[model samples]
Target chain A: MKNRYDIVVVGAGPGGSMAAKVAAMGGLDVLLVEKRQEIGSPIRCAEGVSKKGLKKFLPQIKKEWISCEVEGARIYSPDGTMVEMAEEMAGSEVGYVLERKIFDRDLATLSGDAGADVYAKTNVTDLVLKDGVVKGVKGKHLGRSFEVECNLVIGADGTESKIGRMGGIDTTLKPIDIESGVEYIMTDIEVNDLCNFYLGNDIAPGGYAWMFPKGDNMANIGLAVLGKYLIKKNVKRPIDYLNKFVKEHYKDGKIVSVVFGGIPVSRPIKTISNGIMLVGDAARFTDPITGGGILKAMESGIMAGETAIDAIEAEDFSENELKKYEDKWRPTIGMKNERNYLIKEFFINLSDEKLNDLARSINEVKIKEMSVTGLIAMLIEKNPKTLENLSEILLKYL
Target chain B: MIYVDRYKCGYCGTCVAVCPEAAIDLLETFIDINDNMCKACDICVKICPIGALVDEE
Candidate 1:
């Protein structure tokens, strides 16, 4: 006899955990499986989350998960031009650099508290299907293979989710759309309680370097380079570039931990099939412009959870029914991702010289408050001459 | 032997940096694999700064 669940969510990241939480809350029998022995252990992220976006989904911030409360961010040009602003002025600026271990555990606890069965070290190796409708999952844990049945399946695995691909959802991303990221947790550095962004070709070809403050003397320093750019330039690893930047920028710091990962910058794919729905990085739910997905993952997980309940009650686990989850989010959350893709294209094609000039122009503006969108627009408006150049570059690359 | 496309090398020196055999000479635009000194560890092939170098199978 096989074990059973109303919903089985693969990957116990923020998205999967949140989906389990919502489904279990709605009186559904939910099971969450994570491949890692511990959730959030091999920290692969920069751990930054905007307060505004976070508040839109989660009612309150849990105290234990916050590493530091940031006031705003400083944007720097290649030659070191700087533009500083207050968090209130930029809605997306004020954020918390999280302790993801605590954060991820809390989400799983939320699911378990809501009556979901959570399993770590259980790897979902394959999807079990009956006549083109997903019926369950085949996995291994503790050196034993098992099959677990579920009416609906939610795939929230990260960038390398094989579960989504097995369901035939066309989840493969182009190399140019995937960012190969490397980061270092460094100590003995003096940093203000604000995030710092460095932009220029010298640091990253199609992405930027970030210094996210964790404390007065420690920070997460990292860079994201498009994988295509890495291949194009024949670099050894993205972290090598990050290390050079640290030596030049924060000379006194010593790296304590190094992490490498990838961020998907593509718009959310059409990620639903019969009895299946994909959420989080598996669906490329990450914001293309900023590479932030924790909040988006949580939002989509909530939607997926509620939708899973409907599918289970209908007893008709069809493609059309599962697609409602995608439809509900496609217009709002999906649209934002599409817009951010355009912005990412505009930023990635800029040369180091152009970025420095753009930064200088931005610093000259007496703007008090701006959205990340608004700031980019202001740069274009102030330097009308660059718009044509930007358009040309965008046409060639995007 | 390792083959390199000269055009793609950005001289980021990653191959030189990661080479355990110290067989690569960091150049302005690329690295020169010293065959005499090269042990063919394949680290340079994996860590090529621009991914310009490939090992012949």
Candidate 2:
């Protein structure tokens, strides 16, 4: 294997693979490395992506990658009151539940086909730094230590992004800004085409539990609780919550697989660093409210790839050149993340009674005609007492 | 022996991911640490996001 490349991408997730593919397509020597023996194994995500968001980047998705095409969602309140919305009304909330194993492998395969060299089980241990500038990475590839030099490194590692830290970026999360999640892939159950979200303090304090249907008899049932709430409730792990939820709901469902991971619910860092760009969870690009990142990861990956190419063409791989990625992603996905953060904060503070009230109000509204601001306005009108709690949020969002 | 704090665990499976020996198994309701498989390397203790896993005194 070559010991040097123009660009070396760490972590062959969606973001890394996408960056590699685009950079390789631009005729750059790109190396995409994965610590895992397999490109995508022991998947961590619930694997749900809205068709609208995905189609914007990927023109057409292959059929094999999609496990289930959901038409809508059923949101359950604490008291089990359900409020359902169709895909169109739900907007970005509805789409395909992907087979992430296949999706991730396909992404890596695409990067390879685009002329990027891909390696698995190549764990990057540390950054190869020259005068505080990231020149490359040193790691073990199949038990042999190797150092690969590159002009630029893309940290597409997930939430636990070691590369981001090695590049001198603070990727730490406040307890409130971390969502600890656990999920079970279960079969021998009946699930509709509608994806389901259960909200209430009892279910998943500071977050929500979800049932993303993969098929009529199978689904990825999971819950994410805010780190702060987990400690507050004296909850041991997210799996405990999952166990309780499953016992109540899917008593007959047999567990086929289990997955767990953390989601960063905080804002993106101010600077991702020079000569090293961070994408996906490494950059904290996932939505704070939904904990959904696949779309944003790919989107930012494309932006980073294009920016890297531009930087290479300009013969400047400085922070100034890499700042273009931050500039481009901020106004688009970054703004949405900020808004979602506000929404998440608001939801986290509400009591179960308040959530029930909110759900009841939502049930009465014509959700299709209601914007987020409009919904807030309606909530205040219906429950005038909630004005004190919601006025500030309304002022900002409305 | 490894100690798992039942209250602090969010069961994100970071321990399992980092454990070289695969000593940790996330069961239906809790994380099971196999004593035979555990090398007390403390990788799980360090990797735990919620600081749920601990080494016995």
Best by DockQ: 2
Per-residue lDDT of candidate 1, residues A7-65 (tens digit): 89988989999999999999999989887788877776899998777777777889888
lDDT (C-alpha) at residue A271 in model 2: 39
Candidate 2: residue pairs that collide: A235-B7, A236-B6, A236-B7, A236-B9, A237-B9, A237-B10, A238-B10
Backbone clash total for model 2 is: 7
Leading candidate by lDDT? 2
DockQ of model 1 vs. true complex: 0.04
Candidate 1: residue pairs that collide: A233-B50, A234-B48, A234-B49, A234-B50, A234-B51, A235-B49, A235-B50
Q: How does candidate 2 fare on TM-score?
A: 0.86
Worst 10 residues of 2 chain A by lDDT: A366-375
Runs in model 2 deviating more than 4 A are A88-94, A369-398, B1-52, B55-57
